[model samples]
Target: MKRLLKLYLNTFDGLSREVWWLALITLINRAGTMVIPFLSLYLTEDLEFSPSTVGSIMAAFGLGSVVGSWLGGKLTDKIGYYKIMVFSLFVSGLLFVLLQYLKTVLSLSIGIFVLMLVADMFRPAMFVALSAYSKPENKTRSVTLIRLAINLGFSAGPAIGGLIIAGLGYNGLFWVDGITCILATLLLIQLLNPKKSKVLDEVKVEEPYSAYKDKAFIIFLFALFLFGVMFLQYFSTMPIYYRDSHFLTEPEIGLLLGANGFFIFLLEMPLIKWLENTRFNKVILIWFGALLTSLSLLILNFTTWSGILIIGMFLMTVGEMIAFPFANAFALQQAKKGNQGEYMALYSIAFSFAHIFGHKAGLESVSVYGFDNTWYIFTAVGVLCMFLLLILKQFLKAKNIIS
Candidate 1:
């Protein structure tokens, strides 16, 4: 116990005050995000929604996110992280209040879609700030801590939400999440100041995304979009998969999905050094692809042991650490001086795009074939992504874009 305590203590010694605040902000935001894990179930079981209806409505939420993410990073650059964070949080909270008025899935979907837009728009700003706060050397650790904080909140939010729905019904979760957002927004309003990055400081003029026409950057963004599809599985398909199998309880499923973030917290720092820089990107993508492929297959072997599923979650997290932050930082680096927000927003777009397609597929595939078959599809996709990334690395290397 003492040795474990000492190691935990030593980990934070590497962090800074900025990192601490960033983690706190993430914690507060996630603490109230009580809806997403159970959203499909809530819409279907609670609201009497059909599977097709829920999937379609949920897919609309992804559509909003697409626009939100594209703007989030740019807003951070222009005004400040604080302002963007403040705007996003409060607006998102307000959107949550509208959930009560839903009578049909159509109404609910529009509400969710708009709320998602507002919420996701500022997410990239927060992330960009988190990334910028860390020294380049510790970027992975920084990203990991934020992911951990989110999971820490995730660990609690679902259980509490479940209880709340049982007691006060689905409306309770919306109200609670809104209140949490309000509190977190106030903290950001208090702590954040108008500041610009060194890159931002160089240009005081308006810069549009079109000004940068780097093909490598475009290709890189598409690569990340493809990679991000696997991530949405945590929410989009996994819960439905559990439901179809009827093998796990809500709490167990939450833990299974939420555990990915926890594993990310555990292994990120030690593993990040291996993920950083150019030479490793190709190898890392391939390694991640194989892991993702194998894990999906293993999942088909058993459906009852959640512990095994959690291990699969861990493998996905390892893949995430390789893919997400590296691609983000790479995108950041690719941006021309003075357009940090625009570039980061673009970088974040892959997630938005991923949702539109990934969720659609996760739903359709699960309905048509089976969740196990979807895993097979994911394995194939992972392999294809690996090849594309390898080719990308080689192209960048030949042209010296990655060095």
Candidate 2:
């Protein structure tokens, strides 16, 4: 037991204090993330919108995310990451409250779009900050540490959100989520001041458009988009499948979703550390992760048993543990000096675009063809993404971007 504990502790030993602070900030922000997980349920069950309409509204959120990520990257170069994060946190929190009051379909859709635009600006900026705060050797581990914090908080959020919805209803979920965002903003103000940190001083500003011109990077971005579309179905379609088909309660769904976070929290850091020591090829890890993610969804076609759902979630979480942090580290390494924000923004857009395409497509497929067909289609998508990642690997090798 002591030896195992020491090994886990070693995974976190080399990271600087700033990375821990960033993780704390992420933890606080994500702990209040009650809205997104339950948004489909809120729209469908509470607001009486159809599944298709919920998907459309969620797509609007994605559109805003693309805009926010682009603008955040551009702005981070000029103003730095600190101010952008603060603005995003406080304003987005305020908007979450406003979202509760929106009644009409058009109004709610617009509210979601605007809310995500302000809210998602923080993502790329946070990644840039994480890259700046970490050593090159420690980049992937640092990102994973931050993800660990996120999952820790996520493990709590939905479980608590379930209780909130059960006792006080959906309005309570919005209020608590908004309050947490504002509190996270306050914590950020107290903990981080760019003027005091030399990390910001080291960043040399560069042309914002430079990342777009790198052909290899653009291909990488496409691969990320494909991987993202497959992964995001967990958020977009899986909840509906649980609620509508499995007849689980809100709390039960919350616990099931929370299980993903709990498993990641317990296992991801140690798993990555072990992989690193084995001198594993990062690209191969990504390919394997994507394949596992596909298999997770594909399993659902064969069984609707709750045990199967647990097993699927575990596989998906394992895939996430392998793919996402390495992907971020790869992007950080590819970034030219002074263009971390731009590179990270492009990376963030992969997930944002996934939200736009994945939710709309998955929900629409469920509406038209049913959930079984949608799972089969995404299983194929996951296979295709593995090939794309292989192509990306070769492109990076030919360009001598990575060994």
Candidate 3:
């Protein structure tokens, strides 16, 4: 136990103060993330929107994300991450509050699109800020630290959100979500002033790279996109599964989802730290993690027992712990100093694309083919993603990008 504690503590030793502040801001913003988890339910039950309309609104969210990511990247390069982060956070807060008043399908759809467009602008900028704040060697650990904050907030967010919905209804969630975004922005302004900070100073790159022109990186992003499609179903379809198949309550469903975040918060930092010291190829580690994630879904076909749910969630958490931080670090490595924002923006866009297609596809599949077959489809996606990664691995080797 003493040795375990020491190892966990050591994972945090080398990250900069800016990274911690960034992580804290992320925690604050995400802690009030009450709406997305319950968005489909709210639209369907309260607003009496049809399933098709809900699907379209969700798709709009993804479309906005793609646009936001591109615009954010361009702005971050032209202006700086500081301004983008501040503007995105502040405006997005206001939009979240405004979203509650839109009753019509058209108004709500457009509102969600605008909300996400502004909200997702923060992502690529945050990645750029992370790169600025972290030391070269500590980059992956720094990513893990930020992820710890995100997962930790997610662990508490859904469960608390469930209780909030019970007491105050869906409207309460919108207010809390909006307020947290504003509060987080204020914290960022107070704690991490770009003018006062030394790291934001521009560094010259001997060879500048364009993210769009990199063939290998495109392949990598495609693979990440596939992985994201499978990963994101936990938000869209799995909750419905828990309710329909096992007859779980809203709070119970929240607890089950929260468990994934809780496990990652406790274990991912140490796990990534240990993996970083190993000789294994990062892509190979990612492939292995993808396989585990696939099996997590595949396990559902074998039994009807509720105990299987715990096992599935555990495997998925471990797989996420292994895959995500290294994937982030690899994306950062691909960027030259001059194009960090562009590269990370494309990286963010990959997952955004997944959100665009994945949730809609998962829901349609579940509706048409039933839950068991939908799990199979996602499992198949994970396997195909692994194959793509393997191709990328060999491609990297041929180019001497990795040894």
Q: Assess every candidate by TM-score.
A: 0.82, 0.88, 0.92
Tens-digit per-residue lDDT, 299-398, candidate 3: 9999999989999999999999999988998888787534878888999999999988888899999999999999999999999999999999999999
List the global CA lDDT of all models. Answer: 0.69, 0.85, 0.88
List ranges where model 2 is wrong by over 4 Å: 43-55, 165-169, 198-209, 239-256, 299-311, 366-373
Clash pairs detected, candidate 3:
none
User: Of models 2 and 3, which has the larger TM-score?
Assistant: 3
Residue range 1-403, candidate 2, lDDT tens digits: 9998888798898887778888998998998978888998899898999877886787787789999998888788768888999999999889988899998889998999899889989998898888788877788899999999888787778779989999989998899889999999998888777655546224455544478787767877887888888998998699999988789898898789878877887789998888777766677788889989999999997876868888899899999999998888878777744377788888988888887788678888999999899999999999999998888778877877662
Best first by TM-score, ranked: 3, 2, 1
- List, residue by residue over 1-403, the lDDT tens digit for candidate 1: 9996676556555555576777887788887888777788888887787887887887877788887887777677768666788899998987776777686867887888788888987777876676566665565566657766877887778778889889988888889888888888887766654442222213333644451476667766666676677667767687776756657887777667666666666665555644453456533554464456346544755656656665676667666766665555566456544466677777767767887788778778878987777787876666666666676777788887642
- What shift in Å separates residue 26 of candidate 3 from its native position after superposition? 0.6
Best by lDDT: 3
- The residue-level lDDT of candidate 3 at 41 comes to 93
Lowest summed lDDT over 10 consecutive residues: which window, candidate 2?
Answer: 200-209
Winner by TM-score? 3
Q: Which candidate, 1 or 2, has the higher TM-score?
A: 2
